[model samples]
Target: MEIMHAVDFRTQLTSIMETLAKTAVVEIGKLFEENSSFLKLEITRCTRENESLQQKCRLLESELQAARKTAGKINRTEASLSHGSTGCICVDICTPTRLDTGNCKLYITNTLHACFPDTAHRPAIDNVFGKDWCLNLWRHEESNAAPNEDTNLSSSGVTVEPVNLLEEEPDMIMIKEEAFEKCSSDKTEEDQNKRLRGAIQKQVKEILPELDLKKLQNVVNHLVYVVGVEKIDDLTFVEVTDLKDFLEPIQCRKLVKTLKQKDFFQESNEQDETPTEITLTPLSSIESIPEQPFFPYCPANSEWLQRFQIPWDRMPPALTQATATGQRARPGARREFVRIVVAAMQAICPNPNLAACREVARWIVSTYPLTFGDITEEGEQLGNGYSCLQRQLKTRVEHVNRDIMEHRIRRPRKGLATKRGADEESYVGKKFRNCKADSYGCVNWQPSSIPEGETPNSLEMKRKVAAEIFQSAGPRAVELTNVDDLMQQTYVYQRHMINSCPPPSISEIELSWPFLFTERGLCRHFKTLTGIDIKSRFGETLNAKAKRILNYFNSQRLRWNEEIQSLLSEIDSDSDGTDNNKTAISAILLMMKYFKEKETSIFISADATSTKMSIEKEMTLPATPRLIMLGNSLLTSSKWFISIEGRVSHSIDSQLDFAAALAVFFGCFYVFNIEYEESAIATLELIQRFFVRINTEGTKCTSKSGTSRKTGSAVQRKSQNFHPRVATFMQRLSEFEWKTSN
Candidate 1:
């Protein structure tokens, strides 16, 4: 009975499934039919629309043909009139009418006294435009030609009164208004352009009187496009094309080159209302400039001139042309000029004082205003116009002096004993002498003694105690403990250790002074030594200048090396904490490039693929400060370690913000009493003197050589010193700041 009941249930289920499948098939078929019908309707509608568009296009083509025929006939009639007495009269004597075909026609018949063909077509024109139209047209042309006369005569000898077109045909006035406005605007624009050209020419002539007038005028023609343009690249394509049309390609190139010059567009302080009267100084006056003989201060030019076998009285033709005609010399020529001038100064004295340089510069400018004069836009001269010349002279003098000092060449005066060398004044040494910890100058560089009641022996004991606490720590509560006082007491002893001739290795120092490696301990130590809040100052400055610094790097993207370019690309692609690390690393790398230093000099990275044995070998190397990035992708890692004394001394303590890491890296130079790395001295010095503003001077960074001679003391070694590139960078950075501020 159970088997019979099961069979019946299975049969019922089979019948139900077949019925549902049939119903679904019907529904799907209905849906497919509806979709097909909708698609067919859309296709039919589109076909109809396409057919309508084709018909419209054909109609437009036919109307265009008709308009062309009408235009051709009108042009022929106008050409006949132009060859006759009405040639000079530019008048629109046709009334425009729109035809059913959507083309506009000039209906000459609607215009009274409109021009027509000669007497052969006179009857036809009279029938079309009414009688005497040709006669009236001739009279109209004669009247317009002689506007001062009240009447005009036709071929038939009838006197005709001049008619005012606007009064007689008010409707024509509307049609002519647009043409009148267009003509007047073109005339005004032409006049404006002329005035702009004249103004630019006058300014250029006043400021640079020695410029060739023909070339100056050509440049001036293009200056009209730059009336309100700030940058040369900002000129529009049309404006640039127009400029090219006015001058040859080479002349246009020269114009752009001149505009890019730093001194070319200096703002003038002179009042526009009171234009200064310029007096032309004759060549005779310049030729008569009294020669200022060099004495104890500066060397005489005769010695070097004789050495080079150059005629003393006669200057090089290149120099003469540059000075006399104000022609810009080639780079090679200018460099040769500097070399010759430097040789002259170095003959009697390898190092000339500032006064001597200024005196020489003044003589040059005074003798040749056309070449050396630094004139403002208002034609006012800057103090002697010789500061740039003075700077170049000083730089060349120093470069020669460095070579002299490096080779230990002596230039002894006849009557005087050998003077101590001024080369001993290292910018770093100077800062160390009057060292302050912050912008508020204070003399805390050398702490004479430890805190009261704390003897040197007791501080040593406390340092050991702190070390024990650090070593045994499981997240040591540094802030909650009294380790701060212990750290403070041991600071004097720590300085002594750091300043030791052969500074202790990272392990030795850490073992003795473990607290110094911690964030709090490092901050306190740097503050006590230099009076700067490293963490706070680093964060503040980085936040303020990060975008600008990145922008500066971005601007030089094409100029960087592959490694640096790769790093910059990564920075642009990522904006996480890793980006800051890459930014800081790239900045250091770029600075190294600017100073022509090697990357391995200050930085060594460990790749993910790098063998443990290789890193272990790097760890066993000599004691020197270095930024260490662990892992591949070149400093993209979150952890940046400072390796001083062949070991990782401290990890960057910014929770991945590398600005603080950078600050500490710089502070290591001061803290360790380590002279800048020999290979990266200038790069490091610029960071110290300019960005850090530790031991800054009013003078520019002028040193050209990269070698640093060790003085008597290791800590007192001279830096690689100046880089003109750094000076230029500073200048541009300041300008960038000024632009951003405004």
Candidate 2:
């Protein structure tokens, strides 16, 4: 029994072993297959990477060859120039006669100018190159007959007609000579200051020979404005830190050393002129210095007072009645009175300083002691009694000044120069003198009146019909000229509806006017309201500035956020090619950070895995318009969406790129006639000024017909005017461009 049991156990063990062997073999086969698949994938990935590297190498090789050819050409041109060939280098290389384009023209022009900087040699150049040679070179045209047909070359090989490039002006040489003659003829304090500034500039240039003349001028201007230092005697007040923004550490050190030497020379000269002995007068015999008024007081019978009286008489009966109530007026009534007073004040002084505003406020208080006075109920003085009025008057004047500085409207002095004797006129200055400002500032934003031909009921009927058409036939159907006409005719009513208090939700607005949400519809509506071709303006500006925009991008060396850094990397990778979309987006981002604004205000990126959550979170915030990037990353974004009024109303294809997306996104603000996101106002304003070139006084504007409505108080306007940052950005860019050109 034991033997038989043992034999059975052996058989059972053999069977079990066979089963285990079969399982092991199957597992080994599966492992081999998995390893083979992984190896295949790895090999495929390596091959792709190798191909990509090879392509990059090929591109680099081609670029190197082109660079070599350019270097060779430049060398030949330089050789010819050094040898005094006297050939029309500009005509040969820059004229339309040549198939090549780019810095060749700039190079020859610069070389010629460098060789002949004096006016004496300018005639020689003219003799050699012809009377219209400079003009031809600048215009890049074969003939000077078509002087108006000037062109600027861009990196993408596209040509753009610059606005002021072709405008006929006095010859620069003549202008300089006239200026020099004027300075020489006048020995006034102003002329002396000019000479002093010129001397300082010359010294600075000597100290920093590598720096551009423009950059040195900027540095001098910085000193003049910031430190109130223009005279050689003022050199003691300047510190190296004052120039930190404009120069490198080493440059700043060198500049400081030079300034110290200048100061030493100035001291030595003063010492040589100082008298050895001094005399003192008795205190009782000395006459007291007159105490100057803290605020200059204009006489009641002065020109400004007379000017104010005329506008004061033109006040509407209702406003006059309201102010005569003698009690503190309501906000609206007070605003009207303040407007009249401020308008009258500005009429006399188009750009009033704080002291001027104080005088106007004092006059107003003296005239209307009961209604506009800043007094306590107990009749105690309220610190000058005109403080409140002064604040208002100062604020109003500041708003207008801010607008001018921001380039929203042309300078009153600039526009006023055109009108004779009216230089003293009391009219609202040209509010939209700049083409871009005019286009953007004319939007029927905050329209208070309906169209002349349309009544409220008619507008409502048109809206209903348009909504029905949009719902049934869709956005394409509404794009028809007929539908567009209806939309245009009711734009005023639409503005009223969108701006209604306790505003409608995004879904409600979309449902009621779906066409307004379409891309074409948005642009058409914006154009109808603002008279601005948003797409064309944005595109033309972007394309014209494509090379500069890329230069601006590559110049950013500041430590940035991860996202911005990633964008900068992409831009660097695509350095050989120009990508307007990428450059524009990066520029906007960099500018936002430069201005110390939150990036999420104008742009939001969502991970593809959690787009819903990311966007949902965004919606919960305020209804600020935003550009949404919906994908795992910005570069690989699957879609772009414009999120306005807490909803993604428009989706743009990824391939359309961010420029188009931004254009549409920007249009949405005007089409809806909505305010920019509060936090992102600075960033949006930067884009408006830098990209769209629309520097309107205010976004919440009035109708186009009447005198342009004034912007808000100084505080409000200051918040809205991001021109300080924009100006700094532009100044830096200008300096960079000057460097590149030189």
Candidate 3:
């Protein structure tokens, strides 16, 4: 029994040990699988992190390159190139988050120009800024953090904190409130003094309304310069004594009393006026000085200082005084001035004419002329003066061009000579076009020539006498405003212009645009078209008959002219006949009426200056004119014209608005009719005065008539998705298939 019990205990122990061993193996296998899965996940997370960092680095590098390119442009040198793209983030205030590309520099440059026009004249860009205005107005860097030099941002311990793209945080923002300082503290004081003086003038006006306020302000400004205090109450004993020089003691007391009564030293918060920051280049004490230094060092002074100084060579008689207004000396005119000198020199020669390309270096001097010899027009070269003149001329041309494109009607400023005499009242109706007081000064009439002493013969004698007469009347020239006397002077000027050219035997009549509305329009048109006067068989004046014809034409029944209308009237009664000359007159009147009523009319800009009047005028038309045949007559008769959207196509070119177009059309008409006239040659002279841009692009304006178009291509284009209203308008406007046929 003891042996059996011992054997059973041994078997039970062995079974328990086997069960424990199996459980341990299973647990170990499960732990190994979990560890392998964790390792795979960790690897993937690290790889993704590395990729994201690489992308950020690439982004940073590209932005840096773009900033460097922009900084290379003008005015970018003001900001730190290092801080351009780094831990220092630049938020373009104009367009935040979006990279500026080039607009940043352009906006700043334009703003600077608007502020200081003298910047254009100055040699250095740095000199353009006012001392009060901060140069770094556009940029603001992290004030606290020093800019780090680590090109590889990853290495730097200084982390680039992620910015909120949608909103600007206080510290992250670059532009501070006080970035731009408009005026210095001194200027503010000067302005305050001016205001005080203005108030004083108003208060004292009842008793002393005639007081010169500007004069009073000048006195106070000078006092401010010497006193060196902004607040009026802060004036020291010395300043008071200095003020006494200009103002009486009682006056000074009253001024001070009034200022203190208003609490002028302590400005009220209630004042809502805009900050008067900019003045029209107000001169400080130092700038107002005539001489640059205390005593300028010059050869003129040296000559005067010497006891035995040689007499300074001077002109025997003074030619002219230095007048403030811009007026050239009246170089005398020759009989052939229009044909010879004025017509000889071309302002711009795009395609070189060898004869016209000869050197103008004799007229314009050069620096170090020995090394840099005479430059010819053929070489497209310019000396200092010539280059400057060309630059100014180009600027004016561009200005006029921009006006034509944008305004499409009239310019702001008018002609100095013609506008006042003809339609000065027209200008008075507009907001900005009202004639300025100073703008209407001396009658400095154009075509004013001073005689060249080149010919000392009979020509020179005649010019000398004319010049002497002008010189004797110099004071009168200055004195005479728009009085009736100036009209006689203008007639004299007109005489000088017309002597060389013979009068047209063809009953010439020059009518202004306004004169067309009167009865004179038909009379003038008849005379010019037929080369005949309005005289009957018995030599009786038949002006009344012309008036009747004008009235009939005004009724729109006389489509061509009075003669054509009479024939049409007779046709109504079964008797018909029409004259070709009458058709020409009808065409002219039809064109003129259509032009006057046009929605987008080409106006002769009153701002057309003397030197560049033709350029300004010719550019007013959007497109050049083309000859069209109507009824196979070959002549571009007035009937060739037709209306589009109440706009006349041929009228723009046919009118005297563009001299070149008029000459081209009229000359073509005459040649087509197999007739020659001296008038064509004279009109050619007028055409030469203008600088016209010939449209060689082959891109025809939809508004223009008789444009040669390409055909033979069958193109059924796919439909576009334009707005309903826009599509309808375009459809109506582009219906030029019939009208545009050549």
Report every candidate's CA lDDT: 0.53, 0.58, 0.31
Residue 334 of candidate 1: its Cα lDDT?
48
Instruction: List candidate 3 segments past 4 Å from native.
Output: 1-174, 180-197, 200-210, 232-240, 248-742
Q: Is candidate 1 or candidate 3 better by lDDT?
A: 1
TM-scores of all candidate predictions against the true structure: 0.41, 0.38, 0.15
Question: Which 10-residue window of candidate 3 scores lowest in summed lDDT?
Answer: 689-698
Model 3 earns a TM-score of: 0.15
The deviation in Å at residue 445 for candidate 3 is: 61
lDDT ranking of the models = 2, 1, 3
Best by TM-score: 1
lDDT of 3 at 594: 27
lDDT of 1 by residue, 372-423 (tens): 5443222223322555567677777777677566434535565333232444
Q: For residues 1-742, write the lDDT of model 2, one tens digit per residue.
A: 9999999999999999999999899989966654453355357546645644565566667768977986786565445444554443233232343333345445545765765565433322222222354545545554542543344232335443322211233243223355567556544544445555566666676666534444466677556544557456566557778886665444565566556654545544564443212122222222222222222245433445443452567665665775565444444556667777677766676765555665666656555555565433233223344655566676766776774754334345544565755654545464443222222334345554578878888999999999888878975785488897888888887777676666667787788788877777787777766556777777777655655755665666564466566656775665434555655665666666556666776777876654544676655544767888766555455467787767677866445666678888987766665656555665676566566655443343322322111332223333221234444455456546756766
Give me the displacement of residue 263 in model 2, in angstroms: 61
- Colliding residue pairs in candidate 3: 330-450, 331-449, 331-450, 331-451, 332-449, 332-450, 332-451, 415-606, 560-586, 587-638
Query: How does model 3 fare in lDDT?
Result: 0.31
- Lowest-lDDT window of 10 residues in candidate 2? 276-285
